[model samples]
Target: MVFQIAISFSQSIYFPPSNSSVWDTLSISRLGWCPDKVNDFYNYLDEQQTKSFILLKDGKIVLEKYFGSFTKDSLWIWYSAGKSLHSVLIGIAQEKGDLNINLKTSDYLGKGWTSLPPEKEDLITVRHQLTMTSGLNELAFFCVEPGCLIYKADAGTRWAYHNGPYDLLKDVLESASQQNINVFTTLQLKIKIGMSSGIWIQVPPNHYFLSTARDMARFGLLMQNKMVWNGNPVLRDTAYYNAMISSSQELNPSYGYLWWLNGKQSHIKPSGPSSVPGPISPHAPEDIFTAGGAMGQFVSVSRNTGLIMIRQGLSASDDLSGLDLHDLIWERIMDLGCITSNSASQKKESIHLYPNPSQRYISVDIPNTSPIEAKIYDLQGRLIQKSFDPKIDLKGFSKGIYIIAVTDKSNNLIKIQKIILQ
Candidate 1:
């Protein structure tokens, strides 16, 4: 199927100039987000050991924050998220007629890549590797040696998150493209997408891609735009791109060519024995997909909202896979009202705050008949003031953006508005 760019956002998307770090930033208040809520979100991230976090709206930086000594230039490993990188490279290789995923793994690696007898090895194709359905013995874990690749079932019969087979794609790409993985990635994806800081470094059983948070956001934006970078086709194989992000097999509906998809009815998580009961992230938009890795690294793209969020740092929990932290970030995002789907009723019900750029005071105009209470917060999600009156005096308040969360007596969020104090 032809992949179409159906942007639902009202704002025009922005792309940073190639080979430059220059990108425009949008005011957080303009997005109708509570600064205090945003602050709270960051505090949660910091507590979770987040080194860097970024949120992009319409391809422009809405929020970019770093914790402690971490800076924009600090390099971080993507771990298994780099699996998605390999998937894209394989798509490009196929588009160039250099390799076909349908071909058997032995076609490129020769017959002895696996200990499984020749016939059994031949059954494993590049597609199986991409979909994590190689059916290799789970006992092998991270082992790729032939002795460790004993056959447990027919290729494509099962789905298991084995890193060994997936990592072999780098070798396949190297052989097919007649170039190093890093060089091929740079020429094909990094340079084109302005991922100036991205680099793939081989480390034993796997290859890790290291990049800055902005560069990771650039890649997420590329995927958000359906592999198109600044109107230039980065990977024009629409069919492959579509398949890469959609359900690739029946075993794992929430996985697509090494990428994790949200909103699917059921999903089999990494190392889990069976499929789970619900979507990967219940709080995120239904159309969202993600590239997640160890240590809380993530690049989540929401098609419904035209938003891309990236997080990288130490693990937030004992789970090394970081899926739990990924869901937690979505919860915080939901609280911040970042991805709330806008509707006509919602717009009408939205409270209006006037004299927004006021120096000393601001007034709230509620359209609903229900009595409302207001609480004010600063950019850090800190509650600074509370008032039941429609007009609040900001006489001594700091000169900056403030978030006013309006709610009913039951504490249900009625509306949120951002006002600027000069």
Candidate 2:
């Protein structure tokens, strides 16, 4: 458990009035960004149906753009991105002695919250739910009922991304704190960080936090400073804060507690635990951690560069992980030739496969490696074949989904890419 120390900010760090609309902003030209490229970026955002976009450097707004009828004060849903907010609230609850994350979740939700037997269910802890390793059937996904929360594996053994387990976190917070989640949010977090406008609204199976884009920026700024707002300690627990931002488990090094981390050696998505060989946003800073949601809602914080970005939009892609939108934005921003805060982003190893969804044969390209050995596994994790080279012939295999696990000479996983045979 690595603890984080607060970063002391100079007077240049600006904080807005707690109840006012006034904010300090820095010009793009002053930041040495190409004026034409900055406008083109706004055009790209508009073309992508972005409702709002906010960029901050050193706590001062750099660029804030709103599209269509969405004004600066318009409220938008954070969708799954709201999970990061709960992550912070959970830390606060622990800090106040209201709950211990290691305790059995059943201690608060009461026994038989899931269909699993008490002995097996007792194996789950609040931390398991926080990290999305609850071992609950991800097929149950949005269903939070007891019968839907059946056992899939022992807790902490498998890592799966699903919302049913995460949704219960609100209940845990409400139960442990003995207060309504909204009330707790306002008192413990929202007001403390000048983000009082945000509210959790239930839209059936899933609950979302609705707030303005600037309000989202406020939260991101708070996180960028390691949970401090203008030197005011919003979440004073340094250990929990560090743990929340750091990798929570090994199954997905790209994930923290409801937050997506960049620069991990490997990453997996909602598709499954088939690891991909790079950070989610290859064009972004390695220290950029993200909280993203369905469609295109996200808050990305660059711990190394003091950059905080919030984007709210609609995406046509079925990527619930929001990886596509996050990467697209960074790809364009990095191409702007304005900032080189993290130049090492250019050298990250990203996996590429040729003619994906092929029926006969496939070739893999993994940069800066030799003798790219691969293991082909079925959906049930049964190893079907092994290849000494980077090519795989799917002649005898049926048309279905498969996982190609790339490993080092020692058989340790270096990458795993899910491919389709058709």
Candidate 3:
């Protein structure tokens, strides 16, 4: 009986539209984009290091594409972009009355909070950690050398991108939740915002954020929505969101929480373990913020345009240096207002596709007692094929990721899970 119910549920699953008309209707060029600008950016990305890109404006997807083996559902690692997730979750926790940033790290870890000289250890607060000003000695956090790991200064007296300070936040969150960071993130944030398939650490091999580029865009939208989803505020505080978006310290105009700032020189080292790369151009505004990852994974949020652009892939370098891509994205964003009118209506139906990681012969099941429209894309938003009825076969397809979105008579939207053919 349980198997029957499970099969029925699978048979009735619905897929939504891949692109929202609201975003398609906007005049993106007037907002500052030159004609064929996206193509130019895409070309550069191909030349540089990018696998997937998704652009959302005002809660609608403007542009989306995949390169190489990526797709709408491919779960690329977020690298340090995960740091921004840490900040936002902390904000949510504080608003939920679970923890306080004003408290010392000592409050959670107690004596474990110090490897430092006593005076310095006592002064560090959770707030200081959030701002990267905990002054916990760069060498201690880096330095492959052993004796090099000693506290050298007072807390909050300097700025350093030490991973230790950030890692400590995981402990703080866990202490408050009595659960691991993965569980906390899943229950409190991901599922609440309609993200069901996200792994916080260890993607395939190593611990990393494993999520679709679309889901990353959704995360960005949730932030853009101010933690509100489906008319409800999922995050506890607006002030926290504001702070996350702004410069958290006077020492860095380009750093906030664990996210990266786009606009000015923040005295970043750019080469050492603590180094943060400066911008490539001066025309870039200081108002932009991004969730940066090790590869080329980026979720850049622009305050000027209410835009969120996410790019996921391997950027083939070591030191943090990828300003040109951000610049190109902004140029495309300048074309975001009063342009075209998309004639597509809201999709209000449901369709289902199954055996997602199929070796061959995938199936589609629709509930309507009536018919539904379905389209399949091969990770790059390119139409690979279309299916009209309940069952579509994929016998000749290669192994990769694909997205199946469905629409009904009224044009409602539902995006289904990733189909992996391995």
Best by lDDT: 1
Shift of residue 353 alpha carbon in model 2, Å: 24
Give the TM-scores of the predictions, in the order they appear.
0.80, 0.78, 0.66
1-422 per-residue lDDT for model 2 (tens digits): 00000111123557777888889887765555657788999999999889999988777888899999999989998988998888999999999999999999999999999999999999999999989899998987799999899988999989999899899999999999999999999999887888857989887787889999999998988888888888889888999999998999998888899999987777889778688876687656667889998888989988665678899989887777688789889767644433222322232136566677788788877676655677776533346888887777878996665667665565444554557787
- Deviation in Å, model 2, residue 50 alpha carbon: 0.4
For TM-score, the strongest prediction is 1
lDDT string for model 3 (1-422, tens) is: 11111111111111122333222323444243334656776776677667788876565555687988876667777777777888988998888788899888778766545566666677888888788787767655533222442575666666767766766677788887688888888888877767756787633222456788877877887766667775767786777888887778766656777777764544453343344445432333335577876655777765444556788777656644354455655544432222121332112223456767788766666544656556665432346777776566666786555656565555433333457665
Whole-model Cα lDDT per candidate? 0.81, 0.80, 0.62
Where model 2 places Cα greater than 4 Å from the true spot, the runs are: 1-12, 338-422
TM-score of predicted structure 1 = 0.80
Superior by TM-score: candidate 1 or candidate 2: 1
Query: How do the candidates rank by lDDT, highest first?
Result: 1, 2, 3
State the local distance difference test value for candidate 3.
0.62
The positional error of residue 142 in candidate 3, measured at the CA in angstroms, is 5.7
Any runs in candidate 1 off by more than 4 Å, and if so which? 1-10, 316-320, 338-422
lDDT for 184 in candidate 2 is 98
